[model samples]
Target: MNYLCLAGPTASGKTAASLAIAQALAERGRPVEIVSVDSALVYRGMDIGTAKPGAAERAAVPHHLIDIIEPSEAYSAARFVGDAERLIAEIGARGALPLLVGGTMLYFKALFEGLDAMPAADRAVRAALEAQCERDGLHALYRELQRVDPVTAKRLQPGDQQRIQRALEVYRVSGQPISSFHTEKPARELPPLISLEPADRAWLHQRIEARFHQMLEDGLVDEVRRLEARGDLDADMPSMRCVGYRQTWEALVEDDLSELPERGIAATRQLAKRQITWLRGMPQRQVIACDAPDALARAVECALRLVA
Candidate 1:
């Protein structure tokens, strides 16, 4: 199926732009569906932090693959690839265009460039990795990854604990360097691809700060409070480790922060910076410099040209 992927750094207006594009397509009487590519958005009760669309917006356009998992569960790129393919096929069967959207670079990359053939996730291995992480430190495991899969290690930052653990876990389960299995192929054989990006970092930084503040006002703290109240405080869980959520959890439990919103905003800004760094690595993407209002039109024009 032909898919249009709208991806960029956090606060780059991907969500709003994708919605607008879907609206435009609907106006043109074309079939369309928005499939989330966000890792954080998959979790239930993560709306405020993940910036999920509200009920009204979702009612206006069909959205898929959202709120299907709990914060305590693990979600991976491979699983996303499988689920996304299935969803896209189902959407296609219904005569709709699947518009992929979010700032999850790895998800987009995994969809386009196929992942390495690694063993299935072994819970025991993951448990062992977690234990190793606490006993030896994430840095030690990262260094071990460098020895085992230097290519992946080189691409990953030292503080990227999740990825470090994942690579190590793959090696442990399969007894092969995850790097050795890193073959670059399309996750799904499909039509031509179009990737949209932000053209300016300065403007995006402003948007990032503004968005975080808006999220707080929109009940991000309350969302975290609810999640915490549900007894899902396991920091090792991916959702708890989400950028804004994790930092908020930290401030709420460990640090006695009177200004919780401020703390959450700070952490979000840092995450946006890392997201910008990730986007910069994709130099080949068709980037447009503009805010949310302008992004959808730019993306639509680009998509029309690519698919023309």
Candidate 2:
């Protein structure tokens, strides 16, 4: 069975390109289904900020693994891999090509390259770390991490409490540095991959800024407000930790609405930078310029060639 993985940074036109490829293939009497590879898109009520395909779009082309979980719950790369593997099999059984599309490079990596062997999350250790963070602040834990695993500490930001806690938890559970577990491991077999990005960095940045403002205009704050009013979600949840949602949640809580757009855009750009860095390390992917006028046509051609 042939598979197509379309990956790129957020707002790089991966969805439209994938939809076009699916449509073109359908015209050729070949059915294609999209299995979203995005982490943020999995949460319910995270529509606008996640850039989830609208109802009309989803109706036009089938999508899987989206809106499969509530915001109050946690979803992990392991869960994503399990869901994607099952979906791939189902799509294959139906004789349709499976197209994995999104900006979540970690999910793509876990799906294709497999994950590191790591211990499960120890709730007791995590709670202890959380308590330590609340009492002594995140910097103290970061300092402790520096003493134990300087490599991971240097790589993570001092304010990254979630990761800092996890790294510490890993150490507490396994008596080994988390970084050591990141060494190369056996991987699952995958099909052809096409990575898309704008050739002009400036253009992509502009698009990021513009799209953020557009999201604001499209009621992103209101969406966050609705999520907050639900009383079941909180800022610390993984779903709420998404780039724009996090900034917007803080802005709403701190009553600093004016800085919301700027902060959200900045955070999104940082996310894109990290995503691009990951994409750069992926081997054997056909990279395409998403900003090209004929990008969709080029993508369809690439998909056809891959499956042929």
Candidate 3:
């Protein structure tokens, strides 16, 4: 059975494009269901910042792998792969195509190329590292990583606390650098992929800025405030560490909301850059200009041609 993988940078119109593809397929009597491939969209109460499909959209189309976990709980690529595999099979059984959509390139990579056998996350060690980060700051932990795992540390920014923590945790737990575990391995072969990206970088960046401000107007701050009020979630958690959420959380704590929009937009642009880099490396993907006037029609045509 054929499947669809819709990938793109943040605010590049992957969601709308996927919906259009699914709608077109449905009109052709080949019903399709969307399976979210995003890491942040899996968490509840992170609606605005994550750009989750609203209720009207959900009611119009079937979606899975969204809002399946809480903000405090951890979700991994392995879990996403499992859930996606199951959903794919179920959708196929129902004679509908599965359309995987989002910007989480890591999850897509894991789903296509099997994950490496890295050490399991040790909560105790992770907690220790988190506590150390809180005490000595992320730079201290990054410097420590540089000392122990210079290869990994060199690739990651010092302010990237989540990755730095995970790399350090792997080293402390298994006595091996995380990079060494990234050896090539056989994985499940994915179906046709449609990658959406803007033809103009400036257009994409402007879209990112506009979307972030729209998110703020749509109550992104209030959403984060609600999560903070829960008392269990924090900036250290994977869910809260999401690009926009992290900046907003810091703004809230620092009592300086003035530059939140700018920071969020910058971080989102960086994220888009990383995603575009990853997509460039992917094989068998049809890249489309997401800002085109006929983008939706183009996406539907590409998806149909691929699956055909």
Candidate 4:
């Protein structure tokens, strides 16, 4: 199916650009709907930390793939591919442009092209990794993952024992970084992709820090606490493992809320780094400097051309 994609790091103006592009399309008497590519935005109670579109924004433009699931459940690229394909066709059938937007590059890759067939889980290796984790702690395993698979390491939170152990298991089983498997997928027709990236890393880092702090001010810790009160979620869940949620959860557990700001900001910056890495890998995408004064206009122009 033909569609348009706008991707970038967290806090890179992707959401703002999507809203602008949709509004621009509306002004031209063309209908448009945003299909979120973010993995985190799927959860119901994850509004503040995910920076999900507010009621007014969702009222302005139709949004899909958001608030479709609960925090206790996991969302995968395979599931995203199926859901997105259906959404794209439905939106097009309704005479609206299917505009995909978010920093979840894996979902974008899976939707436009295809996902890599990752290796099967080695139970013995996983058990050993679990034993190691139990004995030495998640930090030890996370460090080993950093040594063997830095790309995957950058993508996972240090407290994310589930993915950290899984990365190590894959490395031990295949003797290669999990990142390599993603590159092995055959190239195919991708949607016209517009990437919102900052020209200066520092600019993006500053925004990451500022936005995370803003989440706290908007009740990020309380948000995590409410989720924790659910008693069904933990740091191991993919939802809790999100940048801000995991860091805040840990801080609350450790009885040190003061550390939440630093931890959350640092984790978010790391997430941005991995996102930039993913965007650079897509050589065919159009790049707009998200830190530029005209970034929104530039992104809107490119998106309009794609859908025109």
The predictions' CA RMSDs to the true structure, in order, are: 3.2, 2.5, 2.2, 4.1
Off by over 4 Å in 2: 122-142, 151-162, 173-175
Q: Write the per-residue lDDT of candidate 2 for residues 1-308, one digit (tens) a residue.
A: 45789999988998889889999889998899999999999998899999899998899999998899999888989999999989989998999999999988889888878888888888678878878998999999999999989999999989777789999999999999899899776665667888887898887899899999999999999999999999998877788889999999999999989999889999999889888988988886888888888888888899888877
Q: Give the TM-score of candidate 1.
A: 0.84
Worst 10 residues of 4 by lDDT: 182-191
lDDT of 1 by residue, 102-187 (tens): 87878877777677667777767887898999998998999999888899999898998877888998888878877777665634
Over 4 Å off in model 1, which ranges? Answer: 120-139, 147-151, 172-176, 184-196, 258-263, 277-284
Query: Over the full model, what C-alpha lDDT does candidate 1 score relative to the true structure?
Result: 0.77
lDDT for 212 in candidate 2 is 95
- Candidate 2 — worst ten consecutive residues by lDDT sum? 183-192
Pick by TM-score: which candidate is best?
A: 3
TM-scores for all candidates? 0.84, 0.90, 0.92, 0.85
lDDT of 4 by residue, 1-308 (tens): 36788899999987789999999989998888999999999999999999999999899899999999999887888889999999999999998889999999888767767877777767578778867888999999989989999999998889777678888888898999888887655667767889998999999998988888789899988888899999998776779878899888889899999878888888898788888888898877999999999999999898788877
Residue pairs in clash, model 4: none
**Clash counts for the predictions, in order:** 1, 0, 0, 0
Winner on TM-score between 1 and 3 is: 3
